[model samples]
Target: MSRAKNPKYESMSLEELRANMEKSKKELEHAIHNKNILEQRKRIVERKERSHRLIVKGAEFEKAFPLSRDLEQEEVQDVMEQLQNSSYNKSIVRQVYIAALHKEQQQIAEAVERAEKGDDS
Candidate 1:
């Protein structure tokens, strides 16, 4: 047999209804407080993300503007133009440009091979 519903909810006096309304209001207030806390957490995370993006952007800007190189800008540009025209393996180009003794050259070749194999430290 189905149980009967509570009479207080089914047909309450005015005072009883007001009491129930007050209870509902308190629950609603608690929910609003929790929502505000969640919103504050979201803002904190968003701020952190924005800060990380700014840091990355700053690093990129520095790379594109290497400090104290202004005196040699023209010469650097000329070499850069030559490198662009050469169409060389740019990754190993720095090592190739530095002349070395025979033993050092052998070591460099081995290092490059290892690096290409994803094994170099």
Candidate 2:
């Protein structure tokens, strides 16, 4: 049986790269429809490698490529505001609130890192 070379497209030839990108795009669209976190993450990693290849090849990649809406700024802000204003037992709320904050921070950090690296994802 033949092996799957790699899911990453950066080091692949042009045809392989395009195929990988198309696969990623379709997976992303499907993930959007079904709201699957695993598919969404697979898309992120695949597309990020695609973007890196485009950069290396001097292609003009679109800056406004659609991003997944799962962890948007508005949602994070709403969660933060709710955590701050809601009255609850400190012992109970603190751990949950801190966990949410940590998750939000990780999402923000990932987004910023992707942005800095020129991946519009």
Candidate 3:
């Protein structure tokens, strides 16, 4: 025969009520621990995905300028930040690289010119 459901909790003895309260607290703590574990796993997955995307994008940027030196991870990260902060079109990755190179060259040339003038003085 099918067993009857447990009797109403209101009819339970004081000891029974205390036992139930302890059981309920344990269940609540277990549920909370599981929830925290799942959140940690989720964060780990998100971090891996972000790192993978950065690696792939950095490789793509390098591919576009095959003759140029490969960009270091820090340089790629800086460019990524700039791309995110600016309104430039994402497709112009090569152009961005070239522009940055030109700017660096200009800065170096200006510094050399100043140094030569100082030496002459």
Best by TM-score: 3
**Any idea what lDDT model 2 has?**
0.73
Q: Taking the tens digit of each residue's C-alpha lDDT, what string does model 1 give over 8-54?
A: 58888889889989999999999999999999999999999999998
Clashing pairs in 3: none
Best-fitting candidate, scored by lDDT: 3
Model 3 lowest lDDT segment of ten: 65-74
Q: lDDT per residue, candidate 3, 1-121, as tens digits? A: 9977667876999999999999999999999999999999999999999999988975777788563356676776786688677755655766888999999999888889989889532
Question: Candidate 3: deviation at residue 66, Å?
Answer: 2.7
Candidate 3 residue spans exceeding 4 A from truth: 1-7, 67-121
Give lDDT: candidate 2, residue 35. Answer: 76
Instruction: Report per-prediction Cα RMSD to one decimal.
Output: 14.5, 23.1, 20.4
Task: TM-score each candidate.
Answer: 0.45, 0.27, 0.54
Which TM-score value belongs to model 3? Answer: 0.54
Per-residue CA lDDT of candidate 2, range 23-117, in tens? 99999998787777777889999999999986754332123323323547686567557757766645567888899999999999999999999
Worst 10 residues of 1 by lDDT: 91-100
